[model samples]
Target chain A: MATTLHVTLAGNPNVGKSTLFNSMVSGKSRISNHPGITAESVDGFRDRDKDRLLVTDLPGTYSLHLDLPEAKLCRQHLDQDVEFAMLIIVIDAMGLRRNFQLFSELTQLEIPMAAVVTKSHEAQLRGYQIDLELLEEQLGIPVIGAAERSDVRSLEIDDLIDGARIPAQIPAQGQSIEQWGTDLLAKVSKPVHPEQARRRRLRDDRLDRLLIHPILGLTLFLVAMTLLFGSVFWIAQYPMEWIDALFGKLGVWISSRMDEGALRGLLVDGVIGGVSGTLVFLPQIVTLFFLVSLLEETGYMARAAFVADRWLRPFGLPGQAFVPLLSSHACAIPGILCSRLIPDRRDRLATILVAPFLSCSARLPVYILLVGILFPDRPIAAGAAFIGCYLLGAVAAVGTAGLVRRTLLPGRSLPMVLELPPYRIPSVKEALRIAFDRGMSFLTNAGTVILLICIALWWLSNYPSTPAGAEVTALRESAAMQSDPIEANSLLERARSLELRESAQASYAGRLGRWVEPVLAPVGADWQLSVAVLASFAAREVFVSSLNVMVGVGQDLEDPTSMARIRGSKRDDGSALLPPASAAGLLVFYVLAMQCLPTLAVTRKETGGLRWALLQLTWMTAVAWILGTATRSVMMAMGFSG
Target chain B: MSDFPIEDPQFWIVTLLSISAVILLLWSRNSSKKRDQGGSCGGCKPK
Candidate 1:
């Protein structure tokens, strides 16, 4: 007695399929700027006339016959034994011929269908008028013209739903699908006059000339990236500081309320410390995602990819590889997952193998820590050094890709071909939504993983607890005797710091670090650094917290004074713990090392074999160690002391 | 107060977190394997 209709919204990539889906469903589904952003079908429902119409947004694919995973997914969903009331194929009006080709193929399914032509406004702006009635007649289906507006409810989509209720008749045509598509286009659409066409072309060409020009485009790209990274460093500082202070206060509060015991140590030093280290990077992650979303929405990402393609092709990477590589800067998992869009298997593999070389947000805290130590007074130098690390990673990725292409996956690089979507002003609301989603997902997903690791590490370093020695007791006793309040507080702080450091040295992690010190010594790592590096294998950002735990600095690195104290920390031999050479070496190592277990698990799963993952780990670790050792030697030879 | 001195608040918190971590890890691994078997794009095929 209940009427529920199943409908699918399908279309070519970047033809406003997601936008229409969002508008129709009222932002019920995820929408982003890039083509193939939705790799899986998302379902939403609407109530119409006492009946429910369930709309499913399928992944964008160029053709049902294409071998790619997205194409197969589209085909699989379409072939599923569900009684569909209608299939509304969304097409871009500006690109009718190519879009119609898909519609012609869809006709073979023999399902009740309607066609919705989006981007009509863009077409009209270019002086072209599409006859939806003629298109309806030619295709024997209801054709609706939907302008690119935010309000999908205004587009009379209900008429489309109603029209789709009627089964479409497949017209018997002598021509093939391609010919039918061309014939239908010729009959139903008229292009702008020659002069008007020239004018539109001129406008597009003028913009393209600047955006895709060799020297100017590259320069603009560099400038844009510099500003982006600069803002990431500058803007994220405030929120990062707030988070650090909040966590610090929480730790102090807990310490005050609880008596000194294993429970107190675990709460203040283990749990809070670990969570704070990773959470502190949230502001930068949010900023990066927000800005990247804006760029993707503005249609600039396509042009930037186009430019990068020209430069990267000789390095054996196609332009299409640029998106995944760029996305890797956020996190390599999504970046590797996004590689499904690349048509060629070899190119995709190379992209996946080398993507982790890009310095992800996980590395941000480590970079800040070491850079802060290396450049205590020079913020400008620190910023430049930060940018330099990203560049180093990117260069290493491209170089590695080139080598792989030449040796293992030997083949000529595929020539890049891409469609540059019409430029539009980015929507702030959409960008903010995407940024929030990404930030939350990062916090929830990576946060859980990091939190567990942190607790485990805390337990590792805390248990088999060491008792306070004679010197620590003496310092506490002396602090109690000091009459001046300031002096007394300083002495108390000293006693606390001494006790923490002593306990840290006696911990299991400290013992392991001491065991591995000789092996890491040539790379300028002390026992503490060795412990931190070893612990960081679980996750790169863990290095900061592990180091904090090892050095008894507590968990708040956001405070300038705390960071300064960390920078001034010395080894047992009273030598500077992080000299410029050693810091540079560590930075290089972190940049190149395949230290993330999650990334390896993802790689093994993505590449469909542990072989590639093993190769990636072995190759990256070797490269990182060799390069790091060289950097240390070179810096030391140059007399660059801390 | 009670005979079970080690079963304090800190003990419970750490225990809860560790148990949650183990459950999450197992759930994630199982789900990832299922996704792979289902031919979802998220995971690689077993060679």
Candidate 2:
């Protein structure tokens, strides 16, 4: 029987402990330049010569003094986890003074440990050449040098594992942590090329002036974000279309092969449609993670956080919340996941809570539809309203974030103490691995739930069948007598339209729509619009299709005549289907509502509770309703006619 | 062939499979919920 060797990798934030752990176990824990991106502990195993090494990588922490989330988690693992056969103190050679304090604190645990110095090459280049043999002698434990920028496989990891022993001396207990760090720092940091060290510091300082400047830095950050998200949307477009077409063809093929029945319709429209709806967004998700991965690997992501911190701090969000908030513009699933970068539990939760308020790409089609209705003829005005929709969502996200921090969270954002990593040429291979891992993770978690929900919704919309009514029967009879084929086809289409309308009105989902109709009346909506609004909880983009179906419009949402048909329709009370005020209000609602089930699912998963997900839903829905109603009331008072 | 969908064997088979799929999903979700030690956004930050 092979014995198990319980090993752990521990370090300060940004010390590249994860990279070394990956090397040790050939594991794929996502690595980033941002501090504490590993918000959780994970284990990996390796087999060596009749023994199996179970390696746990603990979340990195800078201090035990603060009640920070990462620090608390790390403390719990070290104190309470299974007795370690070995603890690897992974410290950075480049910033030994800064990183060594955590090492000092861990010595109190008195576990068997060895030291591995990371960023060795970076230190040497800047003139600090750490002598591993001398330090190994001083600490009386095995030590090795590992450079993160190098091929980590070249590390003699097996030897390091075999050499683990309880150190003869722990970092001195009496002196302050900083003083101890500096005292040890003098013993090392031997000047190899002292002049180069000055030059290196000078270079970094000069770069920092522009990159993290208050005004210029923020501008650069925004520009970089625009380019990043722009590319995500633009580049993912082709693959998205391909996925759409592929699924469409698959549905058609399934429909042809299956026998005519409700089962076939369910498979084609419910199952396949649901899967495709989720899968079609995969390209956008992949692209967003890919570009962000590249930025993170290049080390600019840390700097970007610093640049955002100045503006975000006043709003009770840390700089780390910037990436997640901006990412929400693409999709809230990854945005909520990215909240792991944040250190405080409350700040992270607040970011996750308000992230869905931002208008994700899912809202774009709804915007184009409603904004088009609001300003039909004036192209410039339509374009401005489209831009205004995006701005409104952004304002809502920030405002909600501030409100949440003050009330539910009840604290200003913890002040940021940042350590900007030196920028490097990003590795495409590493970026691709990070992006792929995140993409697969998304598919496994959010996609499955979305598919199931879509199926359920599809079933709700179709079941308890409504038989053909009087108008539908009359139209069919008229079509039968028409002599010309074209005229016959027109009559058949009219009959189909009436049947759809009747069925939509009588279906369970339709009944739910009617149930909510009175509540939505103040927002300038009747039963049909209420049904669309209710169905959109599945996904905001579904609003356009749901409304179209409820009013008996054709499948082609982009068709001008279909849009015109929607505009020309009326309510049961004989009022216009969507007056100018109502359209404006609906636009506002789509911009602010928590309408994506996938996002809520991810929020629950990320926050580790159903309470947060429910809170996010309640708060955003209430905000959207109040604002939507306000918009309609103001517009109505302004005398906007149908 | 049966006149009604419910009477058809093939219809019943497909319906059974769909219902089973939903049950399996619920079962899987409940199982994972129990297994969760509860604090990771799926990895990278130390537990």
Candidate 3:
């Protein structure tokens, strides 16, 4: 039997821990460039002849004593009774003093360990050098320099294994850990030349002056975000149309092949239509994550957070909240998860509570639909409205955070202290990996949730078979009697649409919509829009699909004729189904509402209590309702009735 | 009321599939919840 050695790789954030892990593990584990990516301990094993080495990658933390979640997780793992063969402490060569602080604290455990100094190339470029042999002798361990090198196999494994098996000695106890780290760095690491260090600092300071300027930074941020959202809307449209057409053809083929029965309906309407509705948003999700990953890798994200910090502090949020809030634009789950990066409990909670207000990709479908209806011929106005939705959500988030801080969780935000990493050209490979991982995760996880909801909604709007009215029956009969094939087909299409409308109205969803119609009437919603909104409670993206199905659009939302028909749809009182005011109201409502059940579930889990989740849901929904009604009222007052 | 068709194979298939999908969804959600809670630093066991 082969001997199995368990080795733990620990490091502070952004110390090339992921790079070393990826190189050592042979692409077996997921890797990302940003800090806090390793949220859990992942185990990977390598077998070299008779020796099998098991490696565990723990979450990055500056110290085990910090009150942060990552710090606690590291402590838990370190305190476990299971003996490890070795602990490889990866550190950035440029920041040896800061990184050694963590090493000094780890010495208290008396664990067998070795140090791997990474990024030596960058450090040496800045006129700094390290005496590796002296450091090894001083620390009484095997210290290796692995700069810009990811291949662990090239290193002497036997030396590390032998070092691990040696008895560890505790450091002298007189000096504090910080003092000990400072003393050790003085002995083994040569200092950079004062002039060179000052020059580098000057370069960073000059860039910071521009990047963090109140007005300049905010302007750049807005321009960058506008381009991002604009690209998502414009570039993703082609693929989205293709997907929509594919699903529509699939449904038609399925319906044509299978007889007009329950199975066919279930397959065509429930399964295919429901899944395609959510999947069409994949292009936007992928593009957003890829671009964001590129920014994070290039070290711009930290700077952006720093810029946002000064602006966000008045709203009771730390600068660190900026990353999570920006991430919420992709999906609120990851955004909530990333809130772990915020150290303060109150700050983290406040950020999490308001994150969902940021317009996520799920709301894109709904926005595009309403914006299309509201401004059919005006592309520039439609684009501005799209941008306006995002800004509205952001303003709402800031206001909500301010309110929360002043009342329920009143406190001053902890000052932001962050290490701004050196900027480099981001690796395209890493960005692609992150994009692929995020896109697949969304499809597999959120896709399942959306699929099930679509099925349930489809079933709700289809069951208890309503008998067609006399008018519809007569229309169908007259269509059958038409001599011209094209004219007859058009009549048949209208008859089918009428039948679908009647069946939907007679179904359970329609009845529920009617019951809730009065409450929504003030917000400019009739029963059709009300039904869609009610169905959207499971997920906001479902609003578009549900409305299409209920209105007999049949999944081809790209068809201008069908879009015009849906826009021209009427309520019982001959009012437009989605008038300008109602469209605007729904847009505002979707922007503010906490309509994602999964987000609520994640909130409950992340906050470790149902109280916070319930409070978030109630508060966001109330805000949405009030604002939605206000928008409707203001629009009506402005005499813009459809 | 219309007669309920217990003998129909299509009916049984739809019921079975629907029940399975619901179970799968619930199972996925439960597992996801567990992963989120268990992996969270806040929810980690106090040392």
Candidate 4:
């Protein structure tokens, strides 16, 4: 067996500790400008010779005191067997005083330490020269200066592995920690050759002044968001149409080749049609995340959070909740996980409870499809509607947060203290990689979970076929007797349509839909729409695919006709299925409903009680239903037509 | 006239296999979720 050695990275928040960790070993720890993003300890490993080196990256903190939860977590993890471990203390070259303060606290542990100073290039540009040799001599430990984007191979970190040992004497023994930190920093840091170009790097730049302005900043943020959502819709349109057309062609080709039977029905409708509904949305997912990644890389997200802090306090939330809320736009799971960054229990739970109200990537297809149906020819209107959906979700989340904080968990949120990371050029390649990874994960899910669902739904809607009703039999007879070819073909088409409709009404899924139709009636959802809604309850992304299956199962998926067929579908009474009122109501419901089972499970675990989860589910459902019904009623009263 | 596909032995065999596969997928997911929750499924498990 090889010998194992453990090394831990410790540092003040935003001191580039996470960047250093990424340099040392390959890890997927989310790198962001937000302080304490490393809410939990993440581990990475490397092997050299016959020995294994394990590195743990702990949450960034200013002090290692036991009272601070982040510090406590670090201590507990370190206490688990620190006898075999060494510490790497990362310091920001530009802010050595506070870094030394944390360093002073860590020396109390009496563990072997190595100091790594990062952002040397940035600091150098600003005229500060950090003397690593002086630091090494003063602290009696291994010390190294590293540049931004340091590669472990070039950093020669392995060269310092053996040199990591207890310092000759720790600082702060003779003086207070703060005073000692100041004195020690003065000795090691000196001003030299400052450049005018880099002077803006130290202080807030002109861009920061405008970005944090109350009016201009908020307006800019909204404009940026609108463009983002607009692009998510418009940019993805071409690929979505291509996927739709491709599936339609495949379905037609398979239908023409295969003999008419259950197998052909299953393959054409269930497999091809079902998967295509989801696959079509891949471009949107990739585009959305890619744009978000690009934006985050530029470090503007922290400033946005800073601007939002003032407005958030009135809603019973701190600016810290903004990161999690923004994360929820991609998925609720990570958003809930990120709530751990909130210090107070009430605030954290409040954030977790309402986080799902933000429309995630899963809801994008549903919004796009409905918006397309609603505003067919106008891209700008569709974009605005897309923004409206996101805005609705945000409004609902914050409103609920206020209500919950006032009633169920009453408490004021902590004051916001945020660090704004320096802006830099965004990396397109890295953004593409993140987007590609997310898109592939979505594709895998569609192939497995969605494929199974589509197959099962097809079976449910296909099985226990009943004999054709009298009307279809009469229509078929009339078709057989017609002499003119065109007239006879038309009669046959009607007969086939009637027969299929009868079959759908009798199938198991149809029966289930009928059972729930009365409850859905208030929202203007008939049995067909009810089936689609129920199918998507556990996995909201399945809404479009399942609706494709439910709305017109056997329609030849031949581009224009199939989509037109769906949009022109009629109810049992021959009225238009999705009138403006019903469509609007359905959108509202989807935005508010707690329709994800996995989210509920996560909520159950995170809150550590079934009661909270149940409350969340019940509260969200009731709010959705009531709001949905009201929207439909109000739209109808205001004279919106089918 | 030939019998329907559902009446054929091959169709039944395929159906059985597909059902088993789905069941296995669900079971594995449940087991893994339990593992993720520290080897005890919360709610019903004793402290």
Q: Mind giving the per-residue lDDT tens digits that candidate 3 earns over A513-565?
A: 88999988877788877887887766677776666555542222333222443
lDDT of each: 0.73, 0.69, 0.71, 0.75
Q: Candidate 2 DockQ category? A: incorrect
Selected candidate, larger DockQ, 1 vs 3:
3
Worst 10 residues of 1 chain A by lDDT: A553-562
Query: Model 4, A397-496: lDDT tens per residue?
Result: 8999999999998978888887676776777886897788678767876786677777777767765666777887888889889898899888888777
Listed per prediction, chain B TM-scores read: 0.59, 0.62, 0.63, 0.61
Over the full model, what C-alpha lDDT does candidate 2 score relative to the true structure?
A: 0.69
Query: Which scores better on lDDT, 1 or 2?
Result: 1
Better of 2 and 4 by DockQ: 2
| Candidate 3 positional error at A551, Å | 4.4
Q: Model 2: per-residue lDDT, tens digit, A131-224?
A: 8887787667788887664455578877887887776444555667667666667886688788877887788778789889999987787667
- The TM-score that candidate 2 achieves is 0.76
Q: Candidate 4 on B1-47: residue-level lDDT in tens?
A: 11225665545653564475467547755764543321111111100
